[model samples]
Target: MIPGGKSFCTRHYKKVTHCLFDLDGTLLDSEVMYHTMIGQICEKYGKSYSKDNAVQIFGMTDREVSEEVCARTRLPLSVDEFERQLLDLARNKLPIAPEKPGADRLLTHLFDYKVPMALATNSTEQSVRLVSIARPKLFGMFNHMWTAASRTRTSTSWRRVASRTNPSPHNASCSKTPRWACRLQSRLACRSLRDFKPELFGLPPFNEAPPSTTVPIHHS
Candidate 1:
């Protein structure tokens, strides 16, 4: 578990009445699966997959990643064909993807408290369904789920979805940029599920101080 994991939530328990989460790296530990599958596929075309490539495609949509890879590798596949292949490969793998640390605990705590929660992911609806099957109980806890595939094909869609899902002034979101943070009015930005600080999102601090800690919190 990340340091101050317990206090991270306890500190912010009261400030938020609703929560929105990013699915891929934030809630599900599925990025490794994506990297492995994409790497294997790229290798089949005699293209190398590097760490930098993975970082560049981290928050991109399926079509975007496919286009990027194809452009970089000169793959002969069309965008649609490449995206289909990726999704086909991912469907089998995502069902077994693990949830990120603290995902279940935080989600369950919020659910049990009757706090409304929504999933805002860059993944397609199909990918989201695979994750739902993999983590049914956890996925079911969300009051709503939105995917980039279902929304308009624009960068602004994520922000629209986040704002649409939680119009409450006290709502909070956990995600990196372009997925759920682009133009959304969020109180906190969590780089990963484990390193979140609820207190930063307007939740009151814990009565007792937690151990000093620091972790990378990505922003875009």
Candidate 2:
């Protein structure tokens, strides 16, 4: 368990009735696999793939990452070809990846409590399956799951699916109904999760709430 995991859960339990999780770095420890695979691909073409380059493409979609790599390294493949080859390599590497520290503990706690939870990831469904193959039970616990490959590959479409699954009470403009609302708004915005900020999507702000209620947990 991570330090302060118990206290963090206890403190926010009451305020959180629903949770939204990002898949790649937040739940599964698959970023390293991706970096390695991409590095190998670049090396095959006599191109350099550095940590600095990986950092820049960390949160990008497969197409975006492919385009960036081609732009930076001048790889001989087109964007579509690069994306296909990258995903093929990822399919072979991601299954061996593990979950992040404290991910299982937090997910189990929420599942046992029957908290409504959903996965909101920028990964394609195929890529998600590759990373999740080792933990079917854990992935199955989500009430809903949304991936970028489901419909049009647009950020707005991705947000629409996520918002539908875990409607943010903070967004009065959102039309979808949420399962429950809580007072404690906890967010995990860090390097491991690609420094994603839920507030940009109109999710609740992380503020100190009174003891009477806790808020939803949103991880990305």
TM-score per candidate, chains pooled: 0.71, 0.67
How far residue 67's Cα lies from its native spot in candidate 2, in Å, is 0.8
Q: Estimate, for each residue in 33-95, the C-alpha lDDT of model 1 and write its tens digit.
A: 999998888888888988988988877888789999888878877888888889989978999
TM-score quality measure for candidate 1 = 0.71
Strongest candidate by lDDT: 1
User: lDDT score of model 1?
Assistant: 0.69
Stretches > 4 Å off in candidate 1: 1-14, 152-159, 162-220
Clashing pairs in 1: none
| Candidate 2 per-residue C-alpha lDDT over 1-220 given as tens digits, one digit per residue, 9 for 90 to 100 | 0011122223332244356677777798788888888888889889999888998887677878999998988998898988888988987778878888767766776677665577877788888777666678888888677787665543344345545553332343222222133123223234443243223332333333657656788999
**What count of clashes does model 1 give?**
0
Model 1 per-residue lDDT at 40: 85
Instruction: Estimate candidate 2's alpha-carbon lDDT, on a 0 to 1 scale.
Output: 0.65
